[model samples]
Target: MTYSTENTLLYVEDLSVSYGDKTVIKDINFVEKDVIRTGNVTGQVIAFVGRSGRGKSTLFRALTGLVKPSSGKVLIADTTTGIDNDAKVVNEGDIGFVDQKYTLFRNKTVSQALMFALRNKEITKEEKEVKIKEYLHQWGLEKVKDQYPNELSGGQRQRTAIIEQIFCSGHYMVLDEPFSGLDVGNIQDVKDAFNLMTASHEFNTIIYSTHDIELAVELADSIYVIGYPSIEGKLADYGTIVKHIDMKEIGLAWKDFGLDHMEVVKQIKAAMLSS
Candidate 1:
């Protein structure tokens, strides 16, 4: 394989999001926001972190066209043809957005849902089945293919949602609290799945948002500490901190100390600065 040194993807300039008069993210800008640049290729993972009211989700929605931004332009290169509409222009199979409150269609069977996605991408029937099987097996959902969302456990449901998006050839995934409700084991499973997806795919990136600082430090290649109504945050490069700090200080674990782990905090901060 040849390596190129001039690849650039997904450029956002002075991006901001607003709800009527209330601004979520303000003057958010990055030359290569969540982008990887090679000679002719680029991939990147940007993890967004902030309090409940912060514009983390709002920024994501604006970039993906679900929400409109008050100012700035989001330039997604390498996948789409134009960046004019802001809502319409995007890379094909680029953004796989998973909502916090479960977005998968409960009526559709797992296989049917995945097939629907594949079909939308112009994949043939035979190819769709093959891909669905592959995803089901890899995600440990082979047994649940016929099960509905209501029948599965919370972890299984989340995995199903993630798998549906991935099978459609989505390279960039915007996971809104991907670990919404799950046990420690399930959380690990989600992480493993995410790792596997990134490892096997090309031009893949993830923008995961969560209030859990530990989750951010563990899952994100880079971390963004966002404040409310502001389109900016403190960004720490990948693995920059190894120690975890006070979740309360970061607005996580609110009033509960049980969710607080000092050792994890120490590791996160250490990892952040080390890298």
Candidate 2:
């Protein structure tokens, strides 16, 4: 659960992403979420939390190659490609991203949809079946795997979408607002899916974005807060970031990973103080 001594798995430094001339975010570092501006992201669960227009989705797009950043680079390992359009740095299966809204083939059954994702992976039929069953059980999608998207409830749809992403065997996974449309039971399922993926597989990193700060605290190992600077209150907004750090320095770390790491909390507090 800890990686105090390991190689850098993913690194993003001085990442400045913008939409045209309008700068949405600058000097944004997604290393360990808010804890650092530029560092290594490995074996880290980073939750990007902010207001509606703080560019959380924008950050996700840039990381996944859906949106090109005006500047900066995302260095990924393994097979997930498109980290750099100009030069190859990583493969195409190392990173997986879950869209904020549910996106599935309404016409295709759950099994069909998952099979579509596995088409190019070169996995054996038995291996694929095993993986599908494992994910279905892990996400509680066993009964509904034979149903279509429209036939399932909102939570079930979300689970299907998440399972599809997790089965990609990516080291880094990004889920945008993954808890938005889920009931209590499904929320627990999604949380369990995360735990199992990180524990059983070497799926080390996850970057989940949400407006729910409380949920982020519960699910994230590191938190990233992005507040947009308005026309008249840029200085004050910067001050708020400072205040956030000050508050966290007084021992406000999230405890969902378990209450056993009291020393981890102290270390996080110390790191915040030094920063």
Candidate 3:
């Protein structure tokens, strides 16, 4: 599975976040490029795995610009300009974030919520309606288009939240513990939503965090482990990226899960435990 990369889709350098006197995460860095594969549309699915109390949630907040970092910066491709390495500092609204709760408008029906997501777009009302319809159909939410958030199932609500982000934002999405609390069937539904998003565009990137190491290995092409680092033979209090694994480089990406994946899962679990 040979693939080439184009422009940098996401870039982070020396990023650190602190709250008051406590430094949560520090010295975080990573880069993800727009993957180009022959005869296939490739999108990035990056996962972060670590023990609880690690800074995964804080990192996600900074990535989505919900919280400001105390140091360093995050940059994503300037889609407003062009795809020619024109980078811009990430700000609020630059990326969409979907949390575990899958929050939605209680009063708005699925169709209405989707339409509201497109309110800032330059397209006309008819065009927006068409786009919403397409997404609802594609995500298998067409039958529930008229349903409100309270009326939908957990999976349906999650899918609607995901689609809302897609329409409101663009290619970049950050999901914080998306698989949390989901049953097996609902988990598959969310997985299907991930596939649909990636298949729809080449630059569509999904960055997520999970405790399930096997699922991280199975779904993500790239995985990062965040944990407290040791310095001078003593463990530090701050969390940072301790390890990164490229599934593509190891011939595990986009392949069926097997013994190889299980081994990687074990490795990740060990990393989490030690850190």
Candidate 4:
């Protein structure tokens, strides 16, 4: 289906980020995107892909409203109709961010970490138990609830982190290089879990940054190939969206793409190179 304004869940308009005088990314632009699907669910899933140190993580931070953009705005849908994004800016609560390291206190069990997230909820101990247990069961995390972060597998730890963020924050989630350190087996497990949650509408939108092109093509509804531009004065600038491929419009099966998926992967890599 053609993408309209109403489906524009999160909008990034003329956004750029910088450390000081050195610009990390600039001219990050995206067109109106079409409907994206995962399993039985239809929502927005955007992927930022590029080489390491290409400012993908920084962009993720900006998207979550944790870091202010050097200029421009990240507009979100605050109404049923128009974007109303002229000067609109989203705050932290409108988005959820899970870091690449999967923030955890030393020696903290998954249950303990979750409880820490709820410390500000003002709910009683019993009430917190009920909520945490409900989500633990929902996320298939009951088996590892008692284990500390160091004791869990990579996939288990990642899943626990995601569950903790959703338990702590609201709907939208942004993951910074979530698949970076996982083994091949664990990578597939994390991918499967994400598909399951997204299919269930547990996350209204999921934005993640990765260097894994093949996986991004398979999982993301929209893939933004970020890279450092080599333009005259733009040298040394950070990454920006050079290619915006809406996977939903590609007409291949979701996550089940075979040979066709590789073709798209090659194209995304080509864009990465050109960016």
Clashing pairs in 4: 24-238
Residues 172-197 of candidate 4: C-alpha lDDT, one tens digit per residue = 78898888889998887777667766
TM-score of every model versus the real structure: 0.73, 0.75, 0.98, 0.85
Candidate 4 at residue 197, lDDT? 60
Best by TM-score: 3
lDDT of each: 0.62, 0.62, 0.92, 0.75
Q: Give the poorly placed runs of model 1, Cα more than 4 Å off.
A: 1-6, 31-43, 80-94, 228-275
Sort by lDDT, best first: 3, 4, 2, 1
lDDT per residue as tens, model 2, 154-231: 778877777677667466788899888678887887777677655643437777877555566666655656664444
Candidate 1's residue-wise lDDT over 129-187, tens digit each?
A: 88889888988999989987788888888888887777664566778888766888889
User: In model 2, how many backbone clashes occur?
Assistant: 9
Better of 1 and 3 by lDDT: 3
lDDT of 3: 0.92
* Residue pairs whose backbone atoms clash in candidate 3: none
Show where candidate 2 strays beyond 4 Å: 1-5, 32-43, 79-94, 229-275
- Which of the numbered candidates is closest to the native, going by highest lDDT? 3
Q: Score candidate 1 by TM-score against the native.
A: 0.73
